[model samples]
Target: MNMSVPFSLLFTLIILFLSVLISSTSAKKPGDASQDLVRSSCVHASYPNICLRSLSSYSGPANTPGEVAQAAVKVSLSRARKASNYLANLRSQSKREQGAFHDCVEQMGDSVDELSKTLSELKHLRSGSFRWQMSNAETWVSAALTNEDTCLDGFKEVTGKVRSDVKRKVTNLARVTSNALYLINRLDQSRQKTP
Candidate 1:
């Protein structure tokens, strides 16, 4: 008995198998779905570029609107903490704008606290109480944004580098917080549409 396969047939089979493997590998990455969800979630944000950039690092597990919102809040909280520390340091180093620095630092602290609360609420949301929990998240995030604006407002009357520097930092922080709030609102809207 002689068993022989044609070279052409073997070559075709090899090509077919390789094509299937390539297609499977190239179609989507391991976490592409989650990343896509993150991108889509950021689209409606007030500052979409900031939202996408800030939340990109946390996109791996952001498979849902809620998860993306949580990521946004986490980013906001982290930035708020950094901003608060920066303000505190500036306050300590400055003697001229004592009152303004102190007020800005205090407001940034409040912003950080509100962002933390928003993150905590988002992380603990349950399907049964998702609406109520989302509402809480929205409120806290809004408060955080407000606190940031107030921090910036403290420097309005001041002139020169201190005000400019504080304004730059606080403005960046506020933009991120605004994006987080927009994402949270999108999440809330998403929940409302689900029957």
Candidate 2:
């Protein structure tokens, strides 16, 4: 009876151990794969937190490096468009900073155009033409980033609520653009590695 009890107890312990191990392993595999993908992609970003936050929401569909890059570009394009609209609204309300607001609006418009070009270039990114496409995208995105900086620079001479508001919008747009550029570079590197 003692021997049977000990065997039963050991059998139960073994089963429990196996169950725990299986559950732990299974639980980690899916989440780890997604997290690893996000971490690895974000590793190449200038703003990893922005990259992670922007891309993690689309982790399910953006499993590959290219997909992640595309998602980042889309996010960047959306941000730029929104910033452009906000700047336009602020430009209309500006009385003291009217000249500054006009210049900033023009810069924001240019930034939006550059971002659009980046998105268009990314769409043409294939393995065969990866270099050319990525180069175009990098150039356009860099220009967009520069334009955002220029917009902020224009605001340097102005003071008040309009300057602050436009600066905030442009800064956020610049961060998103920077994130997109990093992801694009990552995608290019990943493509180069493939056989």
Please name the candidate that would achieve the greatest lDDT relative to the true structure. Answer: 1
Whole-model lDDT per candidate: 0.84, 0.80
TM-score of each: 0.85, 0.85
For candidate 2, write residues 85-189 as lDDT tens digits: 777776344554777777777887888888888878776767678799888888888898898898898778787676788888788879988988888887877
Candidate 2: residue pairs that collide: none
**How does model 1 fare in lDDT?**
0.84
Q: How many clashing pairs per prediction, in order?
A: 0, 0
**Candidate 1: worst-modelled 10 consecutive residues by lDDT:** 90-99
